[model samples]
Target chain A: MLRDALLIAGKDLRLELRSRVALNQVLPFALLVLVLFAFALDPDRGLLARATPGLYWVAVLFSALLALQRSLSVESADGNRDALRLSGLDPAGIFLGKVLAVATQLAVLEVLLGVGVAVLYTTRITGWVLLAVTCVVATASIAAAGTLFGVVAAGLRVRETLLPLLLLPVLAPVLIGATRAFEAALAGSPSEGWPWVGLMGVFASLYIVAGVFGFGPLLEES
Target chain B: MTTEAHRQDIDSTGSNGTRVLGIAALIAMAALALFGLVLSPADANQGEVVRILYVHVPSATVAYIGCFLTTIGSAVYLWRRSRWWELVAYASAEIATVFTSIVLVTGMIWGRPTWGVYWVWDARLTSTAMLLLLLLGYLAVRRLPADHEVRTRRAAIVGLLLVPNVIIVRQSVQWWRTLHQKPTLLANGVGAKIEGLMLFSLFVGFIAIGLVFAWLLIHRFRLAWLEDQLDEAGLDVAIAERRAEGAAS
Candidate 1:
């Protein structure tokens, strides 16, 4: 199962690297959101600095939607879904693979966004360890939940409109937890942030397990 | 005889049992109103605003029940691939969405007089809002155009995800509220001392709402069953018509 997952993850990441969609489009869109936040909140008044954590995660969440859409859209085209199903790889492996691929993309996006926030919002991260843990856990949570719903919404004609509607509400906890943890880390208080990381860890594991068990049936149906 | 039996199956989405349940719900609702509004004494703190609890709390309870039913129905449907369980999940989800909406509106109404705002970032309120959104997501998936098996499978997955989502949302929101050190105004309003009639009113509210929920569930499930039957019957008719046309040509 792990080998199959690695094989599928490697294929998706390679496809993404070739396509450059995430690097070209999603990355820019995320940075634009950060800039837009600065404009809306007025960067000069210290509001951007105060609101950086939330705005950063909000940007990431929106971009994650795009990434998830992109991830699933890959399967939708050219009968890839049918091909993948016929290949006899374990469905659970496909699920974990897609999650890993999306998480890897999101991790890179977060690094850039961290830089974007630092450069644009003049935000300084005081708790580097706390910040790193939150990003990894929260990204896994988002990717797992997103990949799960992405498959659920995959082949439908209304998938474009339906994916966000289905995915965003389920990711509410990740948003709140990640934002709170980011706030704690930025405020130089790692103690308060650790618990939120724990919460995100719980969310991440729950959805990962859910995705594993739920994916086979969903993949067949979609 | 088989055709007659089939006709009887699809005839109506009601029965004597549902009629009894409907009448019982009506009586219970009436009693709830009397006990809640007219008989129950005014509270020292909230006074008239406390009456909304009779509706709000009961609606929230019914909504949670609906969520539980959906979860069970979805899980069973996935396990057994039973259309009956799929319909149950779908019906319960729609009903849950309605009650969750009611809970939100009534909660806001109660919040206005008690918290001096129509909305607050309190954990319960935030979590309930998210629950409403999650239920909406489930309904949206159910509405999407797909083959029956495909749509049912999609809806079941979304329904099954609700429990975990609700738990995480509640926990995260609670921690978010607490970390900010914001006072939970709802704690005071609901935790206040309840005397004889108020407690009785609340109890009556529960029975009334639970009965209403049962009534709705039965009718909605039957309606969904009828829909499935109609779709199949329509397909059969279409196939026959096409064959007749081919024969005539």
Candidate 2:
């Protein structure tokens, strides 16, 4: 299963690297979101700084949506879905591989966004460890949930709109937990942030297990 | 079966059992309105605003029941591929969404008079709102045009996910609320004392709402079954027409 996962993950990442869609489109779109938040909230009054954690995660969430759509669209075209089903690979491995690819993309986005928040919002992060842990756990949670729903929405004509409708509500806990954790880390309160990390961990594991089991049937359906 | 007889069979999604259940629900609902509106005394603190609790609390309970039923139906459908369980899941989810909406609106109405606002980030309200959105997602998936089997499988996955989603939402919202230390309006809203008549009225509300839920579920399931039959009949007609055209050519 692990070998199959790596193979699929490598294939997706290679496709992404060759395509450069993430670098050219999703990254700029995420940064644009940061800039848009600055415009929406006046930066001079320190409101933007206070809301940096939430704004950053919201941007990540939106970008994750695009990334998930892209990930699903990769197989959605050219009968790749059918080919993959007949590829003699385990369905659970495919699920984890897709999750890994998305999480890797999200992690890179997070690093860039972290820099963007630091520069654009002039936010100082005191708890680096807490900040890093939150990103890893929260990104895993988002990617696992997003990948599961991505396939669910993949074969539908209204998939573009339906994916978000089906996914965002389920990810509400992630947004809440990640934002709170980021707020704590940025505010130099590591103790307060740890619990939120725990919540994110729980969410990540729950969805990962769910995706592993649920993906087989969903893959066949899509 | 003859097409005419099949048409007649699918004409009405009703039976004697459902008629009896429907009549019982109507009677129970009428009694609930009478006891809840007239017999129940005003709360010492909340006064008239407290009356909404008759519908609000019962609706919330029924909504949870709907959620539970959907989970069971989804699980059984996935395990056994039973169309009956799928229809049960679909019907219960729609009803749950309706009841959850009622819970939200009534909670807001009660909140306005009691808490000076129509909304609050109280844990219950926030989680209930989240659940409504989640159910909407499930319904949205069900509405997508697809092969019937594909659609059912997709919806079942969403349905099964609801349990964990609800638990996570509730827990995270509770933590979100407590972390901020906002004054909990919900705690004060329902903390008022309930004596004999009000208690009895609330009990009547439960019976009324539960019966209404059962009645809706039966009717909705039958309607879905009829829809499936119609789709099959339509497919048969199309296939027959195509065959006739091929023969003529």
Candidate 3:
């Protein structure tokens, strides 16, 4: 099962490598979001610093949502999703592959978002390690949630309309945690945000396990 | 021998819907509305705004009931391979979403006077919104055009998965500090403000909306079955046309 999962993941990664879809579109989209934020807000340093964390997270989340929309759409548009299911590939393996691809895509966008926020707003960072750790936790949570919901949404006729409604509620916990962690990291306040970071870890782990277990029959039905 | 048994199954299921549940629902709602509006005393703090509770609380109760029924329907559908259970699930979900929206709106109206804001990021309100969205998603899945069996199975799976997510939405306020009021009622404790008459009214309201939901379920299921019959008829026509063309050729 692990071998199959890895092969599936590898295949998805190779697809992205060849297409460079994530690199070409996601990073640019994130940058454009940041630019739009800059345009919306006054350039006052204090105000920019105050709003930077939220702006950064929203940019990343929206960009990730976009990429996730594409990831699932790709599988379904070409009938690859049905093909994958019929190929005797484990549904869990498909979920894992898709999640990994989404996580990798989001992580890249998060980096660009972080750089843009830092440069635009001049955010002060206290603990680099904590920042890095929380980013990974947030990424995993978003990926797991997006993949699980993306599959369900993809099966619907009005998938694009239904995706956000299905995902945003489930994604709230992660969003809250990520915001707090990001805010703390920006403020150099370590103690207050640690719990939220821990919670994000829990959310990520639960989603991954649940998605893998639940994806099997869900995909079959879809 | 089994042909007669099959015929009976079809006949009963086809006709005996809505008559019983619908009347019961109407009676229950009329009794509950009168009791809630006329009998329940005004709150000490808020006077007329307190009346909104009759609408808000009942709506919330019905939504929860709807979600619970959906979960049960999903389980039954998956376990028994019964399309009837799927229809029940789909019908209940639509009713649930409607009630949830009513609850959220009434809560906001009540909050504006009491909290001095139209809305706040309170736990109770936020969770209810999340619940509404989940229910909407469930209902949307049911409406998607696909193979009937596949649609039913997929929706049942989504409905099954939804049961656990509600727990998160319920606890989100407690898990994080928020402005929303804590649950007014729970298993271990009684609400301080709840009077005997108010409690009774609430109970009546619950039963009333519940009956209405039950009635809606039966009626909607009948409609879904009618749709199935129409589809079958269409297929029969198509098959007949194909055979006629072949014969002519």
Q: Ten residues in a row with the worst lDDT in model 3 chain A?
A: A42-51
Contacts from the true interface found in each model, as a fraction, amount to 0.86, 0.79, 0.35
In model 2 chain A, where is the ten-residue run with the lowest total lDDT?
A: A213-222
List model 2 lDDT by residue over A1-222, tens digit each. 888899999999999999999989999999999999999999999899888889999999999999999999998899999999999899999999999999999999999999988887878768899989999999999999999999989967999999999899899999999999888887777899899999999999999999999988887764
Model 3 lDDT per residue over A67-169, tens place: 8988887788777778888889878878888888788878877877777777866776677777888889989989998888788778556788777877777
Best candidate, lDDT-wise? 2
lDDT of 2 at A185: 82
- Displacement of the residue A185 alpha carbon in candidate 2, Å: 1.2
Model 2 native-contact share: 0.79
Q: In terms of docking quality, how is candidate 3 classified?
A: medium
- For model 3, give the interface RMSD: 2.3
Local accuracy of candidate 3 as per-residue lDDT tens digits, B82-146: 77787788888888888899888988888888767877675667778888888877877767787
Give the candidate order by descending TM-score. Answer: 2, 1, 3
Supply candidate 2's per-residue lDDT for B90: 94
In model 2, where do residues sit more than 4 Å from their true spots? B1-5
Report lDDT (CA) for all predictions.
0.90, 0.91, 0.76
Per model, state how many residue pairs clash.
Answer: 0, 0, 2
Q: How well is each residue in A1-222 modelled by candidate 1, as lDDT tens digits?
A: 888899999999999889899999999999999989978987788888888889999999999999999999999999999898889999999999999999999999999989988888777668999999999999999999999999888988899999999988888888888888888888888898888889889989988998889988877764
What is the DockQ of the complex in model 3?
0.50
